[model samples]
Target: MSNPNSNFPLTLKQCRVIREIMKKGTEKEASSSLNLSQSSVSRALSQAEQALQVDIFTRGWSGAEPTSAGEVVISSCNSILQAISDTERQLQSNVTTLLKLKTYVEWRHLLIIEAVVKVGSASVAAQTLGMTQPAVSKTLKEIENMVQQPLFSRARRGLIPQTAAKQLASLFLRISPVAQSLQQSLQSLPNELTGRLSVGMLSFSCQDIVPIAFASIFKQHSGIRLQAMQGPYHMLANALRQGEIDCFLGLMRKGPIHPELIELPLLPAQYALIARADHPIHNDAKTLNDLVNERWIVARHGTPIRDYFESLFHSIDNKPPIQALEMLTFASSEELVIHSDAIALLFYDDWNINKLTPRLKQIPIPLPKPECTIGITLHRERQSTIIQTFIEELKLTIIDKLKTQ
Candidate 1:
């Protein structure tokens, strides 16, 4: 393998530096973590910016933030460097030497550095590298010794990769395509295009959208084995971030708009107050306020539907009544609302799709009509080709399902 740090040391180091700066989100923090004098860090960054012919950081008196161009470059580099590590591990295991290059120290360090970013700590990184913590530290020390400069900061907590790491991060991008192709060639190619995909949906969604016909469309790619996971929306979002599942299908709520996740709107839906035909409040209430003080059976707090109701109540000078019941499942929500005085805040489209009983009526309320948009989402950086294909199949299914309705 060609060393990414040889002729391109400056560029590589700059990329690493930018990653640190971006991660720290400030120059002082970046400089401190990089273990470099502020002036040295600034000079190296300046030279790298000139070399790459792009301004990688937006320098202000306060600190530096990654420029738009820098963000793109860093992202590309991160992916490439990860691919290189996977390639190296495969090659070393197989003892194949098609490419020879010096700077093996740098390559090895790059692997650890990437591991730290991926696993989020030295201990986790060590486990991933199949080495003990001390050995990982020693390897890191060797890299700093060879470079004749510290590339990471020692902390009471753990090692912090710096700007030098970011710069090297960028250099790996240039060489990754070759490494990826080799790795792909070396791995026993799967016959019939097989890949395992785990898909998650809200309980209501599973009951509604994910019927036999929906499963059949996804099964069109026999090589793609699809496993369905059902859970509450928040649980599924947590799973998506933790890599338990590849994608999430549900209403988008305002939470941390994780940079790692990308959401695609599938269809628009609206919210309504649903209650049983036999319920006292259904016949008694004419407006939102009349039902405000009444008992409510809602999806647990933090869901999009719950948030909508909360916002609706707040807008009309009322607080949501103490939740007499919390139903994370659509069946529970539908059953409780239809059988008792409990008012249900639910998505109109989902209610229709699930075909709730005729006893349940959607009570109109004069709040800003909040649309519960159903959408598809997946981790932005971790999506596999199979996941993308399944998502497309899912989208087609939804489109057809909605059209038929």
Candidate 2:
């Protein structure tokens, strides 16, 4: 295994010195601007070089110029600083850079980094890229040189990501989808569906509506790149408003939306508290308060189901369960209730009578009317041709499937 922290001592002071020298084209001016002695500026460069084991500056009577290695390191440092400034600007005014790679950080370098991290082996990444292992290794080394950090360690079978590598991988993952979307948008043919569509779906929609609707859409459109994210309604709704998700489907919230999301209501949903068929309390006539001490598993706080749960017992002296096990995935919540004594609040679609009902039984607890409002929501300006088509299909699906039910 390799050590990332070992023998790596580059500091912020050294980075400043490098940037100042690059901008000033001489150590004397860098020292003057930084309010430091020339010898201190020179020492900063020397220490950085010693740590990196590479000479980044060329010294002569004409003053110092960055060497080949120094140029790459300087570019990366500038990118890092520029990204930080952009983030601060966005925090204040919500404006961001409209272009990709204005800093010359090559996409190929990012691709190689992604492939290696995902595959965990340079050799496997090489095969996937149709390049030799040594070529991939050489590209990785160039990236390491630019960042001036060790990204990964050698393992018995593959490469293991160190802190630096993991950080880079995170950056690539965050931006890769955007890059692909941009590429598809720019290179698409006229009047054809060729772009990425990210949909945030709820558990109820995932079971039938989204799959059936998307399956039919895929049959008609070959260019629609679909990415579905399923979770609690609140999390998915937030993702839609933040632009992390393009659209949200399932139960819509009754609260007012910021940024003015356009909601397309499809149907109404009912919720019920359920437990394993063999649970000790299934045959009882107890109210929700009667099971106050029992472990209850429910959705995370932002969804309508959770909103209903809170509203149901709001009139009680102190209210419902002291603590409920919140879950994002219905599958996990179902398993938790099936094996343990935990009770789960589920939608009718979630505990379909065909499969899960054999193991789980409803607690016969009557919930309030109109427990949830089901539909699709997206930013008003974000509604596009593909998104509109998806919403229509979802509506058609609910109509067709509900009729059968």
Candidate 3:
């Protein structure tokens, strides 16, 4: 089997040795307790440290002690072991087979299992993992034999994961990003940060704040690589949950979010009603009621902005303009407003106002100031140094730009 670079750098044996040494306070005691030679225990620690690119332990005459980085890694090891034990007990499996799990289960095994469960076909999983279909089937068979349970049920369309397979795949998905983040954090230098930062951006942020933050990050940390994915909010949220993106930038969602993700509110943004600079309605529009008959450009239903737009007219005991164009992007909305008599709603910020002043102008109609907070969302357990630094830069950029406005 080909072993790729895994998010978790250490093997089960290495983690076991390190955990024993941490508990026993010496390699000799750990070796005796685990029925292994001192050199073997030492070798495991050496290999783990090399893979992580950090010194995990400092050896001395008294005993071997875990370094700062080692403590973090050791904690993760303990968590993994505890999770495995919990799974064994929950499944009520044979003690002997479960005990051998640590020896047989590798990161690659978990990767294959996760791929198979996600794609629901051995052949597709094999293609995704750059392996043959037969190799994938063989690995699955080996895993099933080891666990003494069928992980998947054969179906005409595709394979269906059993409860055990789903549980394992979910566990891998949650921990893979966290482990990778930990490794990157340990390997990064204090003065220079290095890693890939994948970000998901909504339409609102793509125009101004996110790009500025990216520029700031690039100037400060040239070693860091940046990727930005733009899509609808629901699609982006799903991507963030699957560990496909580091963080999401846009307007904060209302109500409670997923337990595994955290929302950090940054600044409040107000909305503006905009029209072409030379529109005849510009001078006559003193209230929203005055423009009720005019053509309007608004977001589609189910979007946060769309809800807000409908609520605005309802507050005045009036229905919103029936003659409307449903638009999603500010660029398209601005273009439609410039050529036609369609008034559009947009963010009323200095950056946006300055950009739109040349062709489009904000109407003077009075509207309620609702709290639309702009912020970032991130996985609770996967914060890395690169992600934290980028957030800091983003906060600074928002504050600086707003202050100037």
Top model number, lDDT: 3
Q: Candidate 1: lDDT over CA atoms?
A: 0.62
lDDT of each: 0.62, 0.67, 0.76
Q: Rank order by lDDT, top first?
A: 3, 2, 1
lDDT of 1 by residue, 28-104 (tens): 77789878787876787787667556666554222454544455556644555455455444334433444211123
Query: lDDT value for candidate 2?
Result: 0.67
lDDT of 2 by residue, 57-171 (tens): 6542234556545655566556544553443333323223242222334445667788889999998988887778888898798767655556799889879987656655666
Model 3 agreement with the true structure over 1-405: per-residue lDDT tens digits: 355445467776787898999888898999998899999998988899888887776542234556556767888788776665565465445434543444456666678889999999999999898888988888888767656677899999899999778766776676566556667766554557655677887775545777788898888887565778677777777777776677887777774257888889877777788889999787998887887788889876766777888888898899977777887677788898999988887664555566565788888887896557777888889899989888888888878886775
Residue 375 CA displacement from its true place in model 1, Å: 1.3
Clashes of each: 14, 0, 0
